[model samples]
Target: MSGLPTVDDVRAARERLAPYVRRTPTYAHDAIAFKLELLQVTGSFKVRGAFNAVLQLPPEQHARGVVAVSAGNHGLAVAHVGKTLGIRATVAMPESAPARTVERMRADGAEVMLLPTVAEAFALAEERRAQGQTLIHPYDDPRVMAGQGTIGFELLEDVPDLETLVISVGGGGLIAGIATVVKALRPRVRIYGVETAGADTMRQALDAGEPVTLPAITSIATTLGAPYVSPATFDAAQRLLEDVFVVSDAQAIEGMLAAQEALSVLPEPAAACGYAAVLAGLVPRPHRGTLAILLCGGNVSIDDLVRWRSTLTV
Candidate 1:
């Protein structure tokens, strides 16, 4: 499979994404170091793909507009891009989504369709396909994967000596893209995916040697709630990627706290799951080489924040 994003594709993605997205900072020090992804447009890495994907659309495609499904980041991403590019977008999201995110999407001119779950939101995206709206996959398209691959391009270009890059896996886009770039550029550099144990579709797929779908899941990392893995991406990881690890909701929350304290970035549980890997010793420790963890998303429910605050007391 063509998991490796070509150097040309990386360059093109850099050009396509340069206008709206930040070149998110790469940080290093005596201890753990990483890319400051909260600097991303819409406050997460999703913006890179959203901006590039929507902007790359032809006039006809733009006119048809775009639609996507997400409980958090992807919805905001497409909505944010639509505002910048004048493309009409609709985001179908679960009703359980944080209010702050829903309001932001609405403010950006995207029609919000609230459903009971992320699965239903995806179904709604399909429903709109009949109306000529193109699907902006949350994390499945080759273009989006290529765009996310730019993260690796930037990361490796800046920190090629990195031994292990820890990234949170949602719908497999970020890991797939980053893995492709790292593997092609420095095959020895390990790429490990950290996912919420509650929704480990990619992990399941890797174990099964094929994409697998879960029946149901309940994880605080709503943005990482991918029930099924994409065959194309799964095959890539199966062939080229390194490892997949799982983290619990409590560990994910702890990682989120570490993000707020160490990096001053309020990452969502899924975004913080990568750090949870370090906390739990999944990537091994007492090493010398650099480790780049993607800070990922900052969106969080007020309730989740309150819960995190309460935990600080006990």
Candidate 2:
């Protein structure tokens, strides 16, 4: 196949990843159905890509180990994959990453490095990659995207008449993979990507007609703070998604609180922003079929929740 993951590649990924990932269930509430990826292993859909990226490596490379850079969830996913598969893993994360997530990676037996910024973490991971360690990129790889595409397969099977899908976009892997499958199988399904206001990587990329880097990330949704989108992901979003919506951090917090009240599930700001778009009337309600929003992660800590509640008047 080409650099982009094909539908057939996604099908193979589903079979290959069957043993490592969860087929998260969808929950219907009022006008929307939520794809509860927050309940996925590692508290996010990132594990699907992590496992697929690592498991595909030739056995000989396991000895050379692997390196990855992430804000939090992807690091946790890579660490967990390393432990489960008996491969050595090292993760570089920004110092601003959640403390609980850092501890989890260490507890999972991966060497964890704390850098001053996300860009430094990426640089560190690149240095390691140049030294022969394989880089299991968070979103750029076709294998990782194929793993995420598995969610599209499940979504279609569960909601056969699904008319619309709203997904939170970070580095663009999640929406790209899902849109590939959803559009391939159900041509008319409208897919939209969402981002918190300060971390609108894909939206900026869309405007530039190519992937563009942000000056800095300022959203409370730290996990959504990718510096830029990959070309493949940008192309996929440009070709497949109906549009990309940007929601404020305050609005995302409101959506988080709403989901907690309605579904009794607490989601991180990154996960809640897509639903925030739905709540803020950015996404149109589907007339005849299901409108699904992906709750992509639930990695927020109690301390963070308390802080958000005290500061943000939601």
Candidate 3:
């Protein structure tokens, strides 16, 4: 629980989470194998970590309830987990988050607190934590990272001779979790990360050799717009990833549209970032083995899509 999660932790997380979460499928589209995590319960892979974290909490802590801060998907996952486990949940989310996601969290009976920015939302959640509610960090906790690592287990089992993996990096939780497992199982497999231009938290962290906070979160991919990556995630990114690629918001939108056409499921701009990198040829074409991209979430609404599309011309 203190250090970075081990492969054993991730394996245990998979078993512990088996009954509670869905094992989302993998699909082949063109040359890229897509891990359809958007089909996960609460519309993202965050639920895996959310469930793992909450389930491991002591009974006394569960009674005290849990609080979280997220752009959207992590809040939704925590809200859904709280509802299922009969625990009171509170989420402080940025006002810029998708309206539909906010509504869904409220529908799950979680207290939804909207702040002007993600940093302010984190502040609110910390205040609530000081008041005794357990803070379920979106990306910083090892338990959550181990939970997210479950995806790596599935990917190796599903993709035949997978050579390269691409994932969108936010606070670095998803990539860290998956990379831990992938590198442990197949050390030769090349693991890569993607970020939108303005929301390049991991890319910046890797460059500076430490976590660096951005001045603003300006990307259309709000889910990938964490202002800074944590030290734990930064360590993982530095040690495990082959490279981190930065792409434009327009390219992410194009990838989202491509996913919509190919898989018939519209991915959120953040989710499409990995695919966007691949499509833009930022991730080299796999010459020997399969290249897989994670389509991580699908929590966008029509209004959200329209707003995101505007980024193209902006």
Candidate 4:
């Protein structure tokens, strides 16, 4: 409960969240199996953690309400969960967060406050917590990580012969949860994490042998732009993750476009980072079996997509 979530913890979370979230589907193309988590209820896998964390709160705590800080997807998830459970929710997001993301959170009935930066959003959330609101951290909480681990549970069940799992790392919650479960269940399955070059918090943490905050992060994949990795997530990644790689923003955009064209799904840059690593040959090709690439989110606006697509060179 304190450190990395166990397989049992993930299993329990899966059962706890069975009614609220979707199982999501997996499909194979070429040698890579795509876990289409973008199809998830809130347009991202964060809903798994959001629902799990919110539901675990006592009724009185729920009445007290919840507060969270997110670049985008986590905010939307928390907002959606709060609306579903009839809890008051407030989300602090950066001013630079995509307009569509802000609109979605507002549409879900959360009081959205736009701060100067993601760091400021976290500070605001902490302040709100001091005022008695239940704080739902984006990635640092064990319960949230346990909820995210449910994705690994589904992956293993859907593809029993899965040889490798490529996941995009933000604050490391998603990969940490998944790696803990996958390593425990299938020790031979290699767990790899991907990050955009400028926002590689996990890679930086692994290199430093501890978590460190960056002065700034700049990536088109705003969802992957955590300033630092949490101690719990760092420990889990160090012990359980096989390797971590980084992809350029250009590569991520290319992967996004490719996924849209081939898979008929528009993946946000963070979601496409892992697939970008594969496409760029940063990850070795699996010779004997299949690899699974987690297409984690799809929350881009058409205008943003058009702008990104226009950047592609001939």
* Per-model CA lDDT versus the true structure: 0.81, 0.91, 0.90, 0.89
Per-candidate clash tally: 0, 0, 0, 0
Residue 10's lDDT within candidate 2 is 90
State how far residue 29 of model 3 sits from its true place (Å). 1.5
For model 4, what is the C-alpha lDDT against the true structure?
Answer: 0.89
Per-residue lDDT of candidate 1, residues 1-314 (tens digit)? 22445656766888888777888887764477768887788888998877767777789989998998887888899999888888899999889877888999999999999999677887889989888898988777777887888888888877857888898887788888778778877888878888988788889988988888888777767788888888877877787667889988888888887777776677888888999888888876536677888878877765877876576431
- Candidate 1 regions off by >4 Å? 1-5, 286-288, 308-314
* C-alpha lDDT of residue 50 in model 4: 88
After superposing candidate 2, which stretches have Cα over 4 Å from the reference?
Answer: none
The per-residue C-alpha lDDT of model 4 at residue 235 equals 91
Inter-residue clash pairs, candidate 1? none
Give the per-residue lDDT digits (tens) of candidate 2, residues 1-314.
Answer: 12579999899899999998899999899868899999999999999988888888998888899889987888999999999999899999989777888899999999999999777888999899898889998899999999998999999988888998999999999888888899999999999999998999999988888888899998999999888988889989989999999999999999998999989999999999998999999998888999999999999976898898798777
Q: Poorest 10 consecutive residues of model 3 by lDDT?
A: 305-314
Considering only N, C-alpha and C atoms within 3 Å, which residue pairs clash in candidate 3? none
Candidate 3 residue lDDT tens string, 1-314? 33579999999999999999999999998877999999999889999999999999999999999999987888999999999999999999878776777889999999999999777988999899898899998888989999999999999999969999999999998899999999999999999999999999888878887889999888888889788898889999889999999999999888888999999999998999888888888897877999999999998887767876775752
Error of 4 at 272 (Å): 0.6
